[model samples]
Target: MRQQIVEAREKAAKDGIRVQRARTPAPDVAAPVGEVTEATEPFQDNGTLRTISARYDLTGQRELLWIANEGKKVGDARCTQKFQFSNNTTPRERPTMLLCWRTSQDKSVVVLAVTPEGRPDTRDAVAKLDTRWSAMG
Candidate 1:
């Protein structure tokens, strides 16, 4: 995942796209949880814009909060709860779906698939990752 992040940044730079990463501070809780390992990156492949991210919480107690906090960033109304995947979209005119899921007790992943206005949907890529992770556990 770290390698992927580095590659994504390099690709983004090569394509003349500036990647701005937003770091969300963990919520204020009574007790401090263990350290979290996280990585996120956005890049373009075959004309499709994709963002992949993962978070691993040692305590396995903040997965839900992390997901909800991410949803809030996009927009509460656009987010919908599913069995495992929490699906949402950006608030732009042509929204890009953000597919996220908790893959294990302490790990969660999020993916975004974007294409040109008239291009075919690339969301399947995101779904594939979800399926693969779910199967591993």
Candidate 2:
């Protein structure tokens, strides 16, 4: 997956697509949850524009960035959106594409359950988020 991130960014650059990433502050190792340092990996994805080092909780899922394909500037159009592949996945399938973006001040992970355009399936999942990342509010 990490290798894919690297390759994807390279590809995006060649295609003139912007990419981004972000990560939360690292925990103290014994901070209850798990090591969060791995969340700060470098952005070597081949086709990325802006790589943000952040994390998001979708529903109850601790989402991680596996790939960031493209990015659109905030308020440049409607939303601060980017194409991404999330590490969180079900037992039935692999990590899929999602719209990891901001709608207000909160960032969110819009899971693409089954939209021909790959839209977020759970509306409330994004609504519950505090960061500016959402689709339809």
Candidate 3:
């Protein structure tokens, strides 16, 4: 438990990830049985390093904007990204979270999803981001 933190910190430094204050989600021993076990960050591709904080347990297409906003809210981390996963047979195509920063500009976001069956679907996540960014302004 504690060792994971130390190891992650070391890896982050190597990846240029500065965890101002890294906090690992404590095990939810009381959580309902079979509920994704405890801890968040699984949704971030399980990279040993932490370039950014991620949440998936309660995270969804809805929170995409929130996370992106947090990134944009800070400094010029303007170029932000997020990934969402779904295990359903029918997946939604509605672009989510600050999708396109500027259509005129070449910058765009890419959304990738993986199913419980190990299938992959990647698309533009910036289309919705553009909408959310507009609303924020």
Candidate 4:
């Protein structure tokens, strides 16, 4: 997992995009299980800044609640167990997508992808992360 993040950063740099560690404040909710691992970076996409982030090791109903609450704070949030992804968008502001799933290793994961309003939807970006991370055990 760490390797993937490193490769992503390197790839962004090679593409002439400046990627920076996301500086958003952590959510107020506390995790009750294993330590949560997070990796986030904001980079330029077609002249617009976009963000991609992931949190790992979440394991409980409380964590799911946290995800739901956080998504609600942003926009109309919807979660699907089958797809293991959440959709949240603030059409008045930005478009964001959140995905959560239990890995083969039994670890719960959440990923977020965001793009400025007026840009394309974040489905593709979130889907890419879903495909990449879902394979990790």
Candidate 5:
């Protein structure tokens, strides 16, 4: 099943679609949860303009970027959102990260990463992270 998803992503990339595999921060790492310091900024995602909601230096490695439905604070309940995949034969729960332009030929957003738990579905804290890399916040 994972292989099928990989193949599909590869096909999309070949067609000019951007797919991002979100990286999970190590369990032992910790960082400050910062406030939103900039207004929504416009960025080029594969030549399309997309707006970024906020950015923070969560891990000090890179600025965490996000797009929220409305104004929100750092580490607030609304900071994270749920995304479901089309495949659901096993009804597994996985945390995923996605970003993209609202309008595009494929209407496909970049899938940054997906992590599945061995046990019951547990929400991944990484999905709520501010790990997006951007030049301007």
Candidate 6:
């Protein structure tokens, strides 16, 4: 656990990502499980990373959906997960922390699912990130 945190911090530094901790409490709608580490950086895609912290229960389902929406908003690519949320269903929360960026050269969106301890799950992070790349098309 400690190793993961250290690694993530090191990667962030190497990538030149400056982690930005929130100064104030986020709204209930934006953050229900309590906000975790929120960080963003300018990268290759010309898209700024927007990571919304979630909790342990989060499966990143909604975050994927949100990313799709963002792609649509930015006039780039749209997310492929097309299931619409019903009014009665409360979407699952996202990971406590999300690390997002683009390939330094290709500008592909990279999404990493972070662990509760605030460390990114490096093993599967890039794979999960690849799933969202389809939306880039």
State TM-scores per candidate.
Answer: 0.35, 0.22, 0.19, 0.35, 0.22, 0.25
- List runs of model 2 lying over 4 Å from the truth: 1-62, 76-97, 102-114, 117-137
lDDT string, candidate 4, 1-137, tens digits:
99999999999999998754322224664544455555565522532222222344443333243343323221222232222222332122233333433333345445444444334333554454455455553
* Candidate number achieving the greatest lDDT relative to the actual structure: 4
Write one digit per residue (lDDT tens) for candidate 5, span 40-110: 32222322122233233343112223333331233322322333222222222233333221112211112
**lDDT tens per residue, model 1, 1-137:** 99999999999999998775432344653434444444443434343433333444322233333233333323111221221222233323233333333343455444444444343243454454455456445
Ordered from best to worst TM-score, the candidate numbers read: 1, 4, 6, 2, 5, 3
Error of 4 at 9 (Å): 38
Q: lDDT value for candidate 6?
A: 0.40
Where model 6 places Cα greater than 4 Å from the true spot, the runs are 1-32, 52-55, 60-137
Model 5 vs. true fold: TM: 0.22
Residue 83's lDDT in candidate 2 = 28
Q: Report the lDDT tens digits of candidate 6 across residue range 81-107.
A: 222234334334343444443332223
61-93: candidate 3 lDDT, tens digit per residue: 222322323333222123233422332222233
Task: Provide the lowest-lDDT 10-residue window in model 1.
Answer: 75-84
Candidate 1 CA-lDDT value = 0.41
Error of 1 at 128 (Å): 1.3
Q: How far is candidate 5 from the true structure (C-alpha RMSD, Å)?
A: 16.9
lDDT computed for candidate 3: 0.30
True lDDT of residue 59, candidate 3: 27
lDDT of 2 at 117: 41
Candidate 5 achieves a global lDDT of 0.32
* Model 4 ranges off by over 4 Å: 1-32, 43-105, 131-135
